[model samples]
Target: MGFILLALGLVLIAEGLVYALAPSLVEHLLEMLRALSEAQRRNAGLAALALGLILVWLAFRFGV
Candidate 1:
């Protein structure tokens, strides 16, 4: 449990760094999605979900 918390903390820190350094990148991504049609927006959301799942799988596989 301690190790899991530590790993989660590190992930939060990394996410904070990226949020601080490139907030505009996040905004731009949202903007791009806003420009898409409804169906395309839904597809993009599904793609994001799949990507996140892949990342989680990789993290577990690599023991991180």
Candidate 2:
């Protein structure tokens, strides 16, 4: 549970930094994402999920 909270907080911090540093870039990214097909978006999200899972597995596998 603690690790989950830590992960969520880290994610939020990363998201906040992006928005804070490049608000306009975020808007442009949103526009680009909107132009993508739904299937493309789904695949992109799945890829992120898989990468995240791999990172987590590696972190635990080697000792965080």
Candidate 3:
């Protein structure tokens, strides 16, 4: 739980720094993602969700 909190905090800090220092870059990335085809977007979203679930399962099993 402590490690998860630490990881979440680090992610928030990094996300904040990116938003502060490269807002346009983030916007451009979002625009690029928006340009992806519907099928491509769906596939990407599914894959990411699957990966996240797998990671969560592994962490739960491994006590990470």
Candidate 4:
């Protein structure tokens, strides 16, 4: 539970930094995402989910 909270906090910080440093880029990215079809968005989401899971698994596996 602690780890989950820490991860969530870190994610928020990272997202905040992106918006602060490049608000226009974030807006452009959002527009591009909106332009994507439902299927495309689903595939992209699934890919990100798989990548995030693999990253966490590797981090624990390697004691990183």
Candidate 1 lands at a TM-score of 0.55
Local accuracy by lDDT, each model: 0.88, 0.99, 0.92, 0.96
RMSD of 1: 3.2
What is the per-residue lDDT of model 3 for residues 1-64, given as tens digits with 9 covering 90 to 100?
9977987998799999999999999999999999999999999999988998898899889986
- Tell me the deviation in Å of residue 45 in model 4: 0.3
For model 2, the stretches where C-alpha displacement exceeds 4 angstroms are none
Candidate 2, residue 40: lDDT: 100
- Backbone clashes in model 4, listed as residue pairs: none
What lDDT does candidate 1 reach at residue 5? 92
lDDT value, candidate 3, whole model? 0.92
Which ranges of candidate 1 are over 4 A from the true structure?
1-30
Better of 3 and 4 by lDDT: 4
Instruction: Residues 1-64, candidate 2: write the lDDT tens digits.
Output: 9999999999999999999999999999999999999999999999999999999999999998
Tell how far residue 5 is off in model 1, in angstroms: 7.6
* Whole-model alpha-carbon lDDT for candidate 4: 0.96
Q: Pick the candidate with the highest TM-score.
A: 2
Residue 61 alpha-carbon offset, candidate 3, angstroms: 1.1
lDDT tens digits by residue: candidate 4, 16-57: 999999999999999999999999999999999999999999
lDDT of 2 at 10: 97
